[model samples]
Target: MYPLDEAARAIVPNLRGAIDIPNCGHWTQQEHPELVNTALLEFLKGL
Candidate 1:
């Protein structure tokens, strides 16, 4: 609902990061499923 990149960058600690899906709004997963899935997979793989 908000600008999560800036907020997450501020509060999510050093090891974590945020993604800003360009041309998308609040419903990122719905609007950009492939991009979101790719990001999620990459993040999960790192874990």
Candidate 2:
């Protein structure tokens, strides 16, 4: 979902606080509900 220049920000161990969903596109929450939900759950748990 990131622009080409910003794509590299999706990599792991980077300072950017983003979760990279493999093979995911623009409709990430819709197309990858399980992955999104899992990430959300984990994030919420930390709060």
Candidate 3:
């Protein structure tokens, strides 16, 4: 996933890179809303 994500970042100029959410699967936002929200806010703040 990391390599695939990196490939996506390379093609998408505005992509901020990948974030790994520990102990979670496909439904990351539902399972780990706090972690997801925090990361999202941090990414947005950077931009």
TM-score of each model, in listed order: 0.68, 0.61, 0.69
Each prediction's RMSD to truth:
3.9, 5.8, 2.0
C-alpha lDDT of candidate 2 relative to the true structure? 0.74
**Order of the predicted models by lDDT, top scorer first:** 3, 1, 2
Candidate 2: tens digits of C-alpha lDDT, residues 1-47: 44443656555545335677788899999999999899889888877
TM-score of 2: 0.61
Q: What is the C-alpha lDDT of each candidate?
A: 0.80, 0.74, 0.84
- What are the runs in model 1 whose C-alpha is more than 4 Å off? 1-10
* Candidate 1 residue-wise lDDT at 35: 94
How far off is model 2, as Cα RMSD?
A: 5.8
Which parts of model 2 have CA positions greater than 4 angstroms off?
A: 1-16
Where does model 3 exceed 4 Å of error?
Answer: none
Model 3 Cα shift for residue 40 (angstroms): 1.5
| Leading candidate by lDDT | 3
lDDT of 2 at 3: 47
Best by TM-score: 3
